[model samples]
Target: MIGDKPAPPVKKTRARRPKVKTGCKTCKLRGVKCDEAKPICRRCISTGRTCDGYGIWGGGGNAYGSVSRITNSSRSPSSLPLTTITTTTITTSTCTPGPLTSTRTLPPLLGATTQHEHRAFEYFFHRTSRKLPGIFDSPFWSTLVFQASACDPAVLHALIALGAVDLGKATRELACAAERVRGYERVALVQYNKAIVSLGVHFRRGGGDARRVALITCMLFICIELLRERFKTAKTHLGNGLKLLGEMRRGEGGRKRGGELVVNTELESVDDYLVEAFTRFNIHSSLFGQDNILLYTIAPHPSCADHAIPRAFTTFRIARLYLDTLINAIYNLAHQVASLSPASPIPKHYTNTQSHLRSSLDQWLKAFQTSLPTLTTHHPLIAPLVTPLLHTYYTMSTITLSTSLSPRDELIYDSHTAAFESMISLMRGVFETILSAHAPLGDEIPDPPGFTADMGFIPPLFFVVLKCRDRVVRREALELLDGAPHREGLWDGIMAGGVGRRVVEIEEGGSWGDEKGQGEVVVPG
Candidate 1:
């Protein structure tokens, strides 16, 4: 039976190919041809390796596995491989002109950073003029020659205008030309001097420009530095500078301007520009100081104008007149406060020392009243000086008030109070008159220098008067009605009301009131 079992029919076994799927992960990663299959692709199994399912498929780990699997896909199906693709085509812009236009060369001397070296290569302006008599010939031609030849007024004006900034550099030569000694050469020299001096006139009318002003200012101080005789000439230039600044301010409205003079745009009224210019001038003029040696010595006195050549007197002289007026006003205020001699005795008609103080006040007022018209006309800048002057008065008053007599004496207190009030009243009246006289008429320009000084001078004066009775006499001056400190309140009030600029225009016939004139106090003389 076992031998018969051996005769069982022999069985046949056949090899089956692996089935393919839609896409292979290895093919996707390597971007090569692959047969898509299920569990294991035919290509993977054919390599005699264990079939790891498509490595790039979602079921796999990160790209590392896929990248490793991609090696199997690199076997080429054809001799011409995909790597043979080359020779790219490119299009360029047509607008570029040429290499010369594109390339720029830097000189060996040129700086790699800030452009310092090319300074020598920069263009220069060389000036030439006729050699005038008695002075070394100027390398720069005078601007005046154009005007004298009756050349284009605009061109001459432009030259004169531009000349201001450079005036300092050329002032010595200008002064030399001005002082030319030969009588025969006088005509040309005179014309040249006129041209130089004309810069000032143009400056007054908003012509001599910024560069000229700077030069003139420099020359002014330089004259102080070098030639004593030239100081007057320098002063003249400076005065013209100041005057021109003032004119621009008045013309530009009330605003002040600075830097290179600019055209008045419609949006920014000329008057406003003028105001701004004037303000800058005020600040600048202050630097000259009340007593700069250059200004004081070189500045012409008012009487200097009487000379045959009135033009020779510098505008500084005019400015000095203003200064003199200020000094006089200060002196008078100080004298008024200090020279408060007691009355002889109580009169039957008058009550006490208060009455005598009033009489003295009236006398002061009368004198000031008589001079009011002339003061406003000549010293129109007085208003702006008031604050400093008032502050000065207050200081003087404090000293006088402190040293005068026993605080316990009612008569002493009364007399002091009366005197202070009367002085204050007189000052107020003076201010009122000033306002009336100088108020700008329709389309009329205020005298800019005077207006500047007046506008600037009032606020401090106002404060000096505000709490006088309390601050000096009353012990509780520090405490105000508000729980806040008195000083704080005063400052707050001033700030809320434009600080220094409030009360610019006093009401007509009312010292400190609105146009309707209510709440106005008639200051008792």
Candidate 2:
């Protein structure tokens, strides 16, 4: 037994070391060793794996990723690469309530062309979603809207159409050539038609959530038309959306026999996300003199004396929302007061409201300044994304308030010349940041003259040139406006500058020659 069976001691086996957790996230996730690169790892790029990025807290995306899931598989090829719209050029769609939802796998559409539809979806995810939220962070564009898009063909097509318009930014030049048609415009029109048909089909079906789908589609329609620069069509879409919302509200308000709300919860006005979007569109539009009914009443922000305002804004978005509320209140108050006769004294209530709004603005500025140092720390892209824009908005809001009662008086703006000068500085810094941060993904991906669905720098810049009589400041504003062609909602920098330059010429009794920017801004045919 000892002779043959003194089994050579079983070969000793070395213990297995914990799997090496090195390299980029995608590589680490694949259980392969990583090269451990900064920002993005080369290993992932080499293998065509999205870097999924690198961070100390976790992998790519924010701390609060979206809970919503897009269960259907995408009809498009999975191999197509996603490009990032630079931090400065693209903004918002967040950590989901998520901008650009975490649900990467899109639900399939029954009749979508694999390549065409997929590219549109990708553009919206990477570009349009971010631009839609404007200065404030909104989950409507990033999360709920995507969810709705995934579920509804109408919404999907509408977004695809929008993506097409946004993608055509650079195509404007080609489009304006009399011999050629706008390539992207053709695509957008096709997709838009499809969306209308699809939405019609939904309406005919009349499902329990038909109204919900309608509201979502209507929002998409507004966005689609707005970005396409068809203000009349967008206005029509908004009117329809508002009408649908009004119907829902009236039904809720005029309920039946019992005290309980007889209206279907799904049909009882649009959900918070939908209503918020619609309300924002209405408010922004009406502030510029559009005849719109305010869907939801804005509760007046408590006066600073009434003990409102946080010690310091916890997030830039929160601060933005507070400022926007005040801006809307100021605009709304100004709107109501503008109707009064020039000889008449401002009403006591209106004066009180103005006083409160002014106080709130002061308090907001104080809080914003306190949090300025830490603002960039809120999100990785926060600095390029919102910092300059917020500063620009604050300056404009201050100007807006001081001239509230004097909307017709060009003379009043002279007092705000310093503020206008500051705006030019802010804009110069912004344009520099935009140029530095914006990296278009080669020639195939057209970077249209900077276009955003949100109201951005254009409105403020146009306002500066229109009201400020200081020729030097006005010219500076015009030059800056003309320098970069961007569309921030209805305010197209090129058109605004061209028209503003003409007005200046007439008012100054002089001619301005050769004032267009690097790219010829051809008006959309």
Candidate 3:
């Protein structure tokens, strides 16, 4: 084994031919490519968009890919995913997807419409919202479920930003959510059913959109009534009936429309109504206290201590109570703020009450602002979760006004006023944000009346008495007022609204349903 000098040139084996680098713009843009002998080629992608070679990019889409750029020159970003171009360079940590661009503009209300038309309108609107980029726009459960169904990193982060969900008020949000979803008719009942089931779980768990339930319930009812007027026919009637039935059932275990579940729960049952009303009554009553709770507070009085929340109030009743409190609280607070008498010494009770309530209000508002994604993503269903925040804000506003006047220290009062101003700004933002999101559907939903001094929840006849204002609002107000039993000062702070001549016209020789200067009724202006 003599190694001859330079062992006869051991030939180096030629390196395997380098695999042809098939240039793929799309793959390169996505930072990945196809697994083929050709590696990546033109047939693999057209117009610089990833073809996935096959439709592998089918059911589950590109999970964590960059924003999808439109290849078609004719189709503008406005028509597709990218709506507004970021001409102003935004230097940030990284670019993130935004809410989807909506294609369909708000439809003009056609006086009224048929059931089929209504469904079509809604579908079209939904499709428009779909085009908007973001997890909320996706059909898969949560935006975070992409590739893997783990909680969205974005969502989890958002939750932290928003603060923890209010465990104390979770049940209330869930109950109201169930009611909000019990409407819409389906082309395929099964699809609706499935939607409700999935939706119900979120709603029941108080996972999202629990606050806007009452407002939506009212909006939907108004929509349906208007639809009835547009198309008067047996089929239309049947469609309307089925839709209402679906709403009552809440899309659980129902027929399929276009392969989606259709929920057809009935909203008209005595039991359903009672449940809805009880939810509001209990919450409001607990906040206001024992003797004041009305209709469905659920607590047993001495005579009916054994009984639970009554099961007879309709969805209408529950909706009414929430709406009444919301409007009244806001108007009252606003008046209180505007009517700051410069001369009076600030009351201690008012200051303390404001401080306590303000903290709670701030906590609630901050939480809701953070939860917008979950609520917006789960619209028409989860949207109600935001409703309670509305009430909370109004309540806080009331406290802010009271506190502003309470602090005896001049410097403290100025500070309180500044804080109160900030709060008012936030409330206005909440209101505008909510209104802007849902293109003004039909007429602007009217502001519900505050409680009248009589304890009867009546819309003041002022709108009716005055000639120039909206008749529909006037009529609705009057109808609500018919239910009130006048109680003194009961509505003093609630209904002295700035709309017109004091809404409560004093009944000569009588107090509002109370003996003049006696009974619970407050004297009318």
Candidate 4:
């Protein structure tokens, strides 16, 4: 009777609500309710607990877990995430936790979007631009070229290609493995191909602006090739650019009947600037090659005659144009002399040309000297940097002109000796200046925008080491070369210096036979 009564008196139990899962990590772990405030939860703040902010995982959870936990895991250390921590204030509950994970990958090699163009341009302006200090300082690279590139797809591509090459070179140097270097090189090639395709299209279209852009692109390609040490390729680009300039000149005066201007209908300041750059390149290139073809084809600009040195002695830019003209004339004469048969006597025209060059050189030096005093008072930095370079070039011009004028049998040893002495003296001045400024030797020095070291000292130094008879002077020049490692245009200082050192070893080793004592050194270009 009792068991039956208990069964009939059983009571109903009420349903309980599911436990709410709401709170910051701190409050949740503490088993307390959280206000879920914007930043620090009110519950955690009131309880004096630090708030762990939220991230991609809700409730401030760590997806990869804590750094300590990851480090302690059984997984290999290399498998761990490459994390970089940066301190940032958390102002909201939704804020990501800890440091940011870098997800931004390098752009693809074949990418040719506007974003990539801008990135390439920035790389060029900051890094590669300094390699061409004087050229970049001018309005062309700094302003006009960029403006043209903005609208001209071909020019933009060419610029990006050059920038890519520079970046590749820079990265390749830092790369420890061959595969990494290859990767960068591939990227450079991709950009280079894009530029070439765009340039080809512009050339086919044929207009005045297109031609101008083509000329600029060709020049840039030459630079790219030279940096890669593809001398033959660089020469081809140089030749093509020279041809383009010729066409532009012809089109300017309507010389060709019914010939329309290809590129732009009218020339701009940029055209003149590009022509000047080509002229400079022509002069520099002639130093290594025997060709006087460029000299004959490209006439000097009329402005080269304006030899008035600025009172500040900062007139090297203008002065160099005139100096290059003189140097080119001398080089052509040397080429002519070198070509003559042994039986042939020195021509009257050779003597006349030598005399003319000497006279012009003297006039330039006189004006240059007159401007020197201005440097002492007005330009401390200019005086130290430019004085030695100007003198070195002057001495080199004199030596080259004088040596070429002499017959093989009757070498002008005295003139050679004097020039060598002058060169040594000037170089000493350069070293002294460098020491005073505490500048790094050669390529170690940083070349910011508008700042480039004068590379004029290299060729002359190399010449001395190869051709000068004085052992002491040769040693000094070699030491300078050994100390400085730089690359200016196509001239690589370290490579040149190494070659000079080898030549010295050959000479010292008595490999020259009878020529060693005779001071009859014949250096191959």
Superior by TM-score: candidate 2 or candidate 4: 2
**Weakest 10 consecutive residues of candidate 4 by summed lDDT:** 66-75
Expressed as tens digits, the lDDT of each residue in 307-419 for candidate 4 is: 22232324555455456667766787787798899878888978987887788788878767876786445544455766778778888888888888654733465548778
User: What's each prediction's TM-score?
Assistant: 0.21, 0.69, 0.23, 0.65
Candidate of highest lDDT: 2
The clash count for each model shown is 36, 6, 66, 9
Off by over 4 Å in 4: 1-119, 134-139, 173-183, 254-268, 290-292, 296-314, 375-380, 407-410, 431-455, 510-525
lDDT per prediction? Answer: 0.28, 0.61, 0.29, 0.56
Candidate 2 worst ten-residue window by lDDT: 67-76
Predict model 1's lDDT versus the native: 0.28
How many backbone clashes are present in model 2? 6
- Per-residue lDDT of candidate 1, residues 96-208 (tens digit): 21111100121221124122111111100111111110011111121122211121222232232222222222322333434322321332233234445644554465433
Q: Kindly list the per-residue Cα lDDT of model 2 for residues 251-296, writing each as its tens digit.
A: 5553322211122112112244555566667666764457665534
Candidate 1 ranges with C-alpha deviation above 4 Å: 1-212, 215-420, 430-457, 463-525
Look at candidate 4 and tell me the lDDT of residue 54.
30
**lDDT (10s digit) by residue, model 3, range 1-525:** 576576577788965543434333344334544343121134333343433221211111232222122111111222233322121111112222332232222122122333433333333222212321111112111111121111122221111111111111111234444322232222223232332344344446441122112212222222232222221231232233334433433433333333212211232212233233223322322222122112221121222212122232223223233333333333333334435675865456545544544453444344445545554453433244234334333443444344444333333333343333433344344344434544422221222221111111112222122221333343333333333322111122222232222332331222222321222333221
